[model samples]
Target chain A: MAEIIAASHGLVVTQAKDISQSSLALEADVVVIGSGAGGAVAAYELAKAGKSVIVLEAGPYVPSSEFTEDFSQAIVQLYEDKGTQTNADGDLMVLQGRCVGGSTVVNGCVAFRTPDYILDDWQKQYGLTNLTVDALEPYFARVEANLGIHVNPEHEINRNSAVLREGAKKLGISWKPFQRNIRECALTGHCLSGCATDRKQSMLVTYLPWATAHGARIYADTKVTQILAENGKATGVLAEVTDPKTGVKKADVSVKAKLVVLAAGAVQTPLLLQKSKLANSSGQVGKNFACHPSTFVVGQYEEDIHPWRGAMLGIYVDEWAHPSKGGYILEGGGAGAVELSAVTQPGLGEDFMDYMANLKKLAGIVTLIHDHNVGEISWDDDKKKIDYRVAEADYPAMKAAIASAVKLHFASGAKKVYLPTVVHAVVENPAEADAKVAAIELGLQSLRMVSYHPQGTCRMGSDAATSVCTPYGETHDVKNLFITDASLFPTSIIVNPQVTVYTLASYIADYIVQN
Target chain B: MTQNKNKAASDVSAALAPLSRRSVLKTGLWAVAGVSALAAGGFALLRPSPRDSLPVPAGLVHLEAQHYHLFSRLTEILLPTDGTALLPAAQVPVVNHIDGLLDALDPAIRQQLLTGLALFDNAAVVTHFKRFVDLPDADALAYVGDWVNSGVMPKRALGFVVTKLTHTGYWMDSQTWPMVEFDGPVSRRWGIPSRGNQPLPG
Candidate 1:
C-alpha cells in the first residue's frame, strides 16, 4: 500500500504521523505528472534504474473490469469533456481519452512504427539529426516487445472491414493487414468503446502495473495545477485533488521534487506550462497544433455482412499516403452500432431504411487524413477553457481526402456512397458518386472534416525561439523541466501516434537516466 | 325462496357446464386494462411540461417532428415484416422511448422539427398524398420511406439528421444492445479471453 498524503490549508499535511513522516515525505528524484504511455515509460525506466519516481495521474485507476463494452458510459467516464464538441468551423467532434492510460486506453490497438518517409522528412525539414528509421529501430523493437505487438492475420475479419479489403482488392489499391497488440482477440468490434475482453494491451495494464511493482508511486485523481519553479531552476509541482463528481476546484498542494516531467498530453501540457508562467521564453508553447481529420463512407452491399463481428480496423490502404492528384490516406475506421447509428444522417432516413431493409448487406469504412495545417490552442483565462482553431489552408487537404475516399468506395464496388459534402452529398449509387468524381476532376471545395488525433501543441526542437522544448524534451530555458507526451511531437506523422508516443517516451526516459 | 332456488340452479349448471374461453379472455382483458390505466395515470403525474423540459428551441421543433417521421420510416425499413407476427417498427415499444426523449427536449427544438416534417409533407407533396397528417400511419410511413429510399428529398437534411438521430437514439435507449453479435459469457465478466470454440451444456 502507498502512503496517503492529504492537503490542508493549501499545504502538504501528513494524515498519519506515526509512519516516519520525514522519510516518506522526502522529495523524489523524479516526479512525473501523468501515467500515460509517455509518463509510464519514463517512470518504469527511471525506477528500474534505482531512482525514486512518483507519478501523478489526473484520472482514476480503472481496472480491467471497469473496461466497459458500453461506449456511452466509457466516453462519459474516460473521455475529456465527456466527448464534447469542438467548434472547429462548425461543431467538429473530437474524442480524447482522459484516464490514467490516456488516449491509449481508448485507441484502436493498431501498431505501426513511424514511417521511414516521415522520419526522413523530419531529418530534412526540421534539422532533426539521428532520427532515421535505422536509428529508431531498437527503440521501436523495445516498445513492441513490452506491449506484445503482433499481427493477428488468422483472426476472423468482420464483414464491414472485409468489405473494405475486398473493395481495395477490386480497385488494385496497395493494402496490408495491420499489426495489433492483441494475442487472442475475438473482435467483437468495440475497440473504440473500451476493450472489455482485455485483448487490448493499453499502457494502463502493461506499463503502469510494472512501474508500480518497481516502487513507482502513483497518485490517481490528483491534477497537477502548476510546475513550481524558482531562480530559473526546477523545484517541484503544486496540484489539486479534485472531486470527480462535482468538479469543485481547490487550493494546490506543493510537492517538492528534484526533477519534473510533464506528460499531460498535447492540450493540457501547454495549458499547464502557460498557467504556471513557465512559458515566458518560448511563446510557441501552445502553437502548431495538428490533428488528422477523418470522414466516413458507408457502402450498401448485396450480402448479409455483419459489420460488428470483426476487428475494428483490420486493413490499411497506403496508396493515398503520398501526394497524388489528391494527398491523403483513406483507411478503414470502425465503431459500434450506437455510434454508427448516431453518425448516420436523418435526411438519409430513406437511404438508411432502404439499406436497413437489407440490413445484412451494409458495410461502412472511414477515411482518415494526415493533415498539414498549423492550428493553435489558446486559453481563456476567465473561462478556463481551451480554444482551438485550425488554419483555413488545411481545409483543402481534408476536402481532397473526402473526395479520394468516395472515389475508392466506388472503385472497390460499393453500390452507393455518401460524402459529407453539402453540394454533391449522399450519392444514391456508386455510379452517381463516380459520375460526380469524374465531373470534378479538379476537386471540390467547401468540405467539412472531423479530427481524431490532436497533436503537436508544445513542440520540441533545438532552438528555443521556434520550439518549446529540446530534443531531450526539456524546456530550453528550464534545466530540470521536461515534457514527455504528444505535445513534444514536432510534426504529425502519417500514422497512429500511440506507438510513437510510447517509443519516444522510452527514448526520453533513457535520456533522463543517462543525464 | 325463488331467488335462492334460481341461484342454486345456476350454480349447479355452472359447475356442470365447461368454462367458456370468452369468460376467461374477458377477465384477462379487464386485468390488463386496470394495469395499463394505473401506469398511464402514474406517467401523467410524473411527466414534466414542455417548457419545464430540457430547453429545446422553437427552431428545432420542426426538425424534431421531422426526426420522428424519419425515425418511423427508417425503423420500418430496417425491420420490415416477414410472414411471422413480429411487431411493426412503428408499434415497437422503442418508439415510445424515442417519443419520451423528444418530450424532454426544449419546445423550440420540437418546433424546428416541423421544418423537417414540411419537407416531406409540404403543400405540393400533400396534394399527391392527400394531407400527410390525415393519412393512415402506415401510408404516411410508406410515403416517407419511398422518398428517402428514392433520394428525392434534399441531401442537406439527410446529412443533418440521419447520423445524429442514429447515435442519439441508440445512446438514449438503455435496452438497445450494440449491433455487434458475439458468443461469450452470459454474465458480465470483464478481461476474460474469448471462449470461441468451447460450448457449455444447455
Candidate 2:
C-alpha cells in the first residue's frame, strides 16, 4: 500500500501522490464518502465497533503544521470552488470548506444543541417522532464530552465580543457566551483560515484521528462520481483519484462495501444522488433547501478595538431568536482585512481607503436568520446550480436585525454604524436608524448574503412519498444506503450545525450497529 | 420655361438610364465597401484594445497578457498609491496575486472573469470617450462608481467582482498588515507547538 506518513496504531492514510497505479480496488464492510463532521463521527463509531471502514475524501489532507493563517492561500487550498461558489443569482457567496475536515476546519467553532422547539416542529409537522430532544440527548452529551465543547470563560471573551455584551446590556437584550468545540483557544483569531494551533477541536484533530486510530483507512483526493447499487441495495462507489492542484485524473478507485454512507454535505449529497440517478423516486432529493443566511453590520468606534486579536467568535444575542419574535440571532466577532474588505462599501478609491484605515477601530455584529426552506439545487448541464432566494416574508426580520444592530452600536458610543446593504446605508444616531433600515430594499444584489450552514436539500421525514430519506436517514427507495449530513436535516436548525451533525451521525451509527 | 425644364429632366433621365456597365460595377463595389467599413467600426467599438505594451510577467500560469494588463490598471484605480495607503498599490504585485488565484479557480470561472474584465474595460468607450486603461484616473474612478451604483444587477455584480479581488489581493500581503496593526499569523510569534492529532488540553 502506498501510504504517506507511516501507518501507526491501526490507521492507514493514503494521499493522491502515493497511488501510482491506474486502478485501485478495495473491499470494506462500510464505506463513508466524506470525512467531515458527520462522516468522521460515523467512521469512528463503526471502526470502534470492529467494522472494516474506508473513508474517501474529495479534498487534500492538510495537517495543522501546514496551516498558514493566510486567507488568500487558505481560500484556494481549503474552500470549495476556491471560495467563488455563489448562488445562481451571483449575489450570495456560498462558503463551505472542501478540505478533509470539510467546513469544520474553517468554521468559527460555535456549537449548539438542536433546540427543543425545532425538534418539536419536526415531530409535529414532519412526523419525525424519533428525532425528539430526549432521544438525541445521549448522542449530544457523548459528542460534547469527547470534543470538549464548552462555553468560553470570561478570559476568552475579547474586546470585540465585549462590544456586543456592552451593547446588549445598554439595550436590555439577552446575550450570553455560546459553547465552542475548542480546548485552549490560543486567541489567534484565525478560525476562518483553519486554526494552526490545533486548539479548535475540528474533525481533523478530533473524530477523524480517532477513527484512524481505530483502523479506518482514509483516501484523500478521491472524488466519488457514482454510487453503485444492485437489486435496490447499495453495493459500493466509483471514484477518481485526482491531483489536487490541476485536477488531472491520476487513477480510478473502486470500493465494494456492504453499506454505503453519503455524507458529502447538503449541496454535493443531493447532486451525487441526481448524477447517479438513484434514490429519487420521491422527487424530493434536492428540494426544501434551507440555509441560515447571514450578514454582518460594522460599527465604527472612537477608540481602537483591535477586533482581530482574540477568538474569532464569542458572545451571541438571542433576545429575538424565537419564531414569534422574528427568529434571528446576532453574534459578536471580528474579521481580518480580507473579510472586512469583501463587505465594506462606499464605492472605491479614497472613500474605501479611508474606511480601511479604520480597520483597527471597527467592531462587527453578525445576524443570522432562520430562513425558510425555499431553495432548490439542480444540475444545469455539467454545472451545479443553487437557486435560493430569501422569501419576501423574511424581509421584516432582516430589517429588524439591521435596526437592532444600529441601535446597539449607537448605544455603545459608536460614531457611525454601517448597514449591511448594497447601497451602503449609514446611521450616525439612533433616531435615524429606523428610517434608514426601513428604506433598505431587498433586491437580488441588495445585501452581502452568505451561508455557511446549508441544510435540508435531501430532507428526512416519515412519509415515503414526501421526503427523500426515512427518519433513520435511509433512502426510502434504496436499502442499506444511508445519509448522515446536513442534507438529512428536515429543517434549518438556525445555529451553527456542526454539533447537531455530530449528534445525528452518532445516533445513526448506533442504529447501524444495532441493525 | 416649365416645358423646357421638363424636357431637360427627361433628357437627363434618358442619359442616366443608358449608363455604361463600368459605372454600375463601381457603384456596387462602393456600396459593399461602405457596409464592410461599418461592420469593422462596430466590432472595434465592442472589442477592448489588445495587449500592446506590457511584457508578460514571469511565471503567470492562467491569465493572458491582456487580462493581466486590465487587472493591473484596475487594481491601481481601486487601490491607489496615495498617501493614505501604507504601501503603494503598484508595489504590492496585486495582479500576480490575482493570476495565482485564477490558476486555482475552475476553468469556467476563470473564463467568466476574463470575459467580465474585457466587457468592463471596453464599456468605458461609451461614457468616457476612452478605453478604461486610457482614461484619466478621475474618469476611471467615476466610471467604476457609475457601474457600482447602476440599477442594473449585472453591472453592479461586475463591479463587486473586480473590487473584491482588488481588496483581497491588496490586504492579503503581509506588508499591508501593519496598516491595520494586524500581527500576522501568531503561531510562530507565540511559539505555539503543533499538537499533531494529540489529545485535547485538559
Best by DockQ: 2
Of the true interface contacts, each candidate retains a share of 0.06, 0.34
Question: Model 2, which residues run further than 4 Å from truth?
Answer: A1-12, B1-59, B64-69, B198-202
Q: What is the interface RMSD of each candidate, in Å?
A: 23.5, 24.8
Off by over 4 Å in 1: A1-26, A88-90, A249-252, A323-327, A346-349, A356-359, A382-392, A421-424, A434-449, B1-167, B170-191, B194-202
For residues A1-515, write the lDDT of model 2, one tens digit per residue: 53323122122469888999999999999999999988988998998788999999998888777787876667666877666666776567677889888899999999999888898998988889999888999999999998889998987888888877988898898998979988888889999889897888888887787787678899999989999999999999999999986669999999999999999999999999999999999999888888888888888899888888898888998898888887988888788776676664745787777778888888898888888888998998888888888889788888888788778788777888887766556776778888888888887778877789999999989998899988998899989999999999888888889999999899889899999
Q: How would you class the docking of model 2? A: incorrect
Interface RMSD of structure candidate 2 (Å): 24.8
lDDT of 2: 0.78
The per-candidate TM-score of the B chain, in the order shown, comes to 0.33, 0.70
> Best TM-score goes to which candidate?
2
lDDT of 2 at A27: 95
With a 3 Å backbone cut-off (N, CA, C), the pairs that clash in candidate 2 are none
